[model samples]
Target: MQNNISHKQSNQAPLYLTNFISFPYQSSQQDIPVTQFMALSPFSVKWSSNGTGYKLYANSNPNPIYTGTGTSFDIPQGFKHNTTLMLEASNAAGKLYAFLTIIISKPTLTPDSITVAGTMDNPSILTVQGTLYAKSTLTINGTLNLGNNNSFNDITVGATSNIRGKATLAQLTANAIAGGASITTDANCALTLQPNATVNKLDTTSVTASGSSNIADLTVNGNITANKASITMMGSWNLIKQGSAFGEMTITAGTDGLVLVYIDPDNCDAGTNATAVITYNGQQYSVNGVNLYQVQSNNALKQGYCCVPVQKGTSWQCSGSTSGNGQSPTIYVYWIPFGADKSS
Candidate 1:
C-alpha cells in the first residue's frame, strides 16, 4: 500500500525516502499474537542500504517460505490458523516497488477467551495441541516446566467445567470425565508420574490435596488401580468404587476397624450406607441408612430402596457397623446365588 511520489530521479542520488517504512507480520488464531507494523513514512530513503532488500513469504511454496530482509520478523514459530501473508517491496534501480497482503489475526477477540499468554516452562510439556472445548472455567495458577520427556494428552473435563493449578504429566489420558466435577476443589493438585502416567479422565473435582483435602465421591467406576499404586487423600474417606469380577483393598481391620475383602478382577480384584434392597442383572436397587450385604446367596430384604442403578456383573458390598444401637448392622452378601439357599 504505497502511493506517495515526488518527481525527478534521473539515476537515483538526489532523492529522499531515507526509510519509507513497513514492518508488519503478526497474527494468532488464539495464541502467539503481537504484530507491529503501524508506523510508516517516518521520513524515507534508507531502503536497507539502498542495495535493495525486503523479502517475506508464507506458505507460498517457493523454496523461500518465510524469509525476511529485516524491517521486522518474528511471526514465524509454528503458525497455523489463518496463514496468508505476502509482502514484497524492492529498490536499487528496480525503480521503487510495493505490494502488501496480510491476514493473521487475534488482537482482542472476547468470546469466552482462549487467547492464553506466552512464556511458559515449569512442569509444562504440551502435546495433543488440538481439540479444546471449554464454554467457561479453565484456568491454571502457574508453573509448568516439563521439558523433553513426553507422553501426555487427553484432557477432557467438559460439562460443568474446571481445571485449576499444579499440572505434571507423563501419562494421564482417561479421556472421559464430565459428571459436573462432583464438587470441585482439586486440593493443591500435583503430578510427577511417567510410566505412561496411566488413565485420568476425571471430574470428581480433582483435588490432590496439599492442605485442606477432599477428593471423594465419584469412584463407582472410573478404573485406575494400575497397581503402580499411589493413592493418597488424607483421612475422611468415601472412596466409592464399583467393578467386581474381583480384587479390593482398604485394610487394617483390628486397630480401629477397616476390613473389606473380596479378592478376584482375576486375583488383584478390586460402597456403603443405609437402607437395604438388592438385586443385580434382574434389576432392582435401593439401599437406605443401615445396610451391608455380601453374596453367595442371601438378600431377603428386597424393595426399590433409594437410588442404586449401578450394574455390570454385580458389585456393591459395604462393610458392617452403622454405629450400633439395637443391632441389625450385619450385612454379608458376597455372591454365589442361583439355585441355592442359606436356611431362609
Candidate 2:
C-alpha cells in the first residue's frame, strides 16, 4: 500500500514595523534648536518611535547609555564640549537610527563684582547697557561710544591719550585744549580764556563781550561792530579828516577822551591869507603857522599846519578867511587821542 502523506504549509503575512522616530529635542523647550547645552545643567531629550525597543548612544559608543521602551531620556549631566549622540530603534523587521549634535556652552556667571588680576582676553567683550562705574583707572584702547542721552560724570585724559569724535559736555575743565578741529558754545554762553592762554586762531560768526576785553595784536579779516573802540599804534599816522575846506566848520570828536588835533591846511594863498580859530571846552585856540608852503603852479597857494587839544563830543569851531581868489583853503585833520597814546 503506497501511502502519500502531504504536509500542509502555513501561509502567514511577514512582520513589518513602521518607524515614527522623531528628531531628539529638549523637553519643554521652544523657539530654540536642541543643538547646544550649558555645562553642569541637566536636561532631558524627548523622542517617539513605533518600535518596541529603543536605545540611545553618546558619541557613537558601541555600548548604549539607555536601553528602554520609554519616549524620553534624561541626560545625567551636560557635556563640557561639543558632542554627538545616536538613537537606535529596533523591531523584528530591522533597526532605525537617528543622530544629533550637541554643542556645549559655558555657564553664565552673574557675580556682583568681577575683579580681574590680569588681562581678560578669552571673552573679549563686556556689554554694559546701564551706568558703568570705575573706581580706578579705566584705560580703553578702542572706541568708546557713550550712547544717546548718556553722560560721563568726569573724565581725565593723560598726555598720550586721544579723544576723538563729537562730544557734548555741560562743563569742561582742562589745563589746555589742543589739537581740536573746532570748539562750539551755546547762545549767550561765555567762553573764558585765562590770562596765560594762547589762541592760535579763532574763527566765528559773532563775538559779543558785555564786559571789557583786551586783545594783543588782533588781525581781523571781517567787519567788527562795537559800541566803542580804542586803537593804539606806534609811529603810525591816521588821517582823521580829508577833503574839507577850512571855514566856519564844526567837528565832533569821535573818541571818548581828550584828543589832540592837527590841522593841515592845503591850497591856501601865502602870507596870513587863511586863518583858522578853534573854540573847544570854553577855550579858544588859533591855528598858528597859517602859511608854510611857497607859491606853486603860477598860483599863490600854500599850506599851513597847527595842532589843538580838544575833548570828545566837543563841537570845535573853525573860523577862517578865504584866499585872494575868494576860495576857501582845503584842510586835512589828524586826530591823536590821549587815551590811546599815553605819551601824546
Candidate 3:
C-alpha cells in the first residue's frame, strides 16, 4: 500500500488599495478642512481593495465607526471637531490601512450678499471685504473695518452703536454724526451737504467755499479780513449834468442812506467858493463842509466828492453854485442797495 500526500493553498493579504483607479496608493494620508459655515452634508470615502472585509476607525479608537464589505464608507453629518480616520481592510492573510485627517478650522465666510432680519452681534472686531447692505439697521458694539476700495449704501447707525477706524464710503446718509476728531475728503472730491442739512457747530482752522455758494444766513462772530471788497450798486455813475450852469438836478433814490456825489468844476476859481446842497426828506444837507475836494493847479479844475444820506424812494436833488461867473460843471450821483457788498 502507498501513502497519499496532502496539499493546501495559503491566503494572500490585500494589495493595491486606492481611492482612484488611475493613481493607486498615490498618497497614504489626506487632509480635509471643515469650516464653520460649511455645509453639514454626509460625505463618503471610496476605495478599491482586494480584501473581503473593511472597518473604519476614528482617532485610533477601539470601536470602529463603520464595518462593512462595501468599497465606500459614509461619514455621518454633524462632525465638528478634528478627527483622524483610519480605514482597515483585511482578508485571511493580513490587514491594510489608509489614513485621512479631518482638520477643523476657523469659520471663513465669503458671501456675495447677506440679509439679516433681526440682529447680528459680534463682541470682537467685524471686518467686511465686499459690499454690505442693511435694509433696516446695523448695530456694531465693537470696531468695524471696511477694507479698501469697498462701498456700502444706506447704513443707519443707532445711538448705542460706536463706529471707529478709517472708513471709505461711496455715499452716507445719516440723521446725525457725532464724536469724530476729523472728517476729510479725497483730492478733487467734494463733500456735498443737502439743502436742509444743518451743521450745528463746525470748529476748523480754515474753510474754503468754491463756485457759487448760496448761504441763507451766515453770522461771523470774529473779525473778517479780506484782500478786496466789491460793492454792487443798484444805479452807478448817473450823469446829472455834463455842461450846465448851477441848477437843481432831481434824483430818485434807490437805497436809503447810501449815496455818492461827484462834481467836476471847469476851473479852480469856479470851485473856490463852490457849495453843494442835498434836499431830501424835506430836509436840506450841505456838502460844502465835506473835505473830499481836490484842486489841481495844472488843469485849473476842481473835483468834489461826498457820500450823503438819502431816504429810499424819496425825491432828492443837488443844487449849488459852482462859479461866480459863467461856467459849466459835471456832476454824477450813485447809490448802493442793501446786501450788495461782496468780497472775493
Clashes of each: 45, 0, 0
User: How well is each residue in 1-344 modelled by candidate 2, as lDDT tens digits?
Assistant: 01111222245322222222222235454323455567656656655556568787878578998899876777766665666767776655556666666766874444567788777554445667565665454555454545454333444443333436555443333434445345454544445543344334444344443334444324456775656765443333455444434456676765433333343444444443445566777877655324433556444434466666665566676664434443345555555653354222
Winner on TM-score (1 vs 2):
2
Q: lDDT: which is higher, 1 or 2?
A: 2
Per-residue CA lDDT of candidate 3, range 1-344, in tens?
11112222356533545551111122243333222222333455666677788887778689998899888655646244555677777777666676766554543456667667666666544566555665444554333444344334434443332435455543444434334334444544444443344444433323343323333334445755544654333443444443333688787755454566666665433434456676777877665312223456343554677776666577777776644444445555555544433210
Instruction: Mark the regions of model 1 whose C-alpha exceeds 4 Å error after superposition.
Output: 1-9, 12-54, 57-79, 83-86, 89-91, 100-254, 257-344
lDDT winner between candidates 1 and 3: 3
- In Å, residue 227's CA in model 2 sits off its true spot by 29
Write down the lDDT of every candidate, Cα atoms only: 0.32, 0.52, 0.51
- Quote model 2's TM-score: 0.29
Model 1: how far residue 162 lies from native, Å: 11
**RMSD after Cα superposition, model 2:** 17.8
Query: What's the TM for model 3?
Result: 0.29
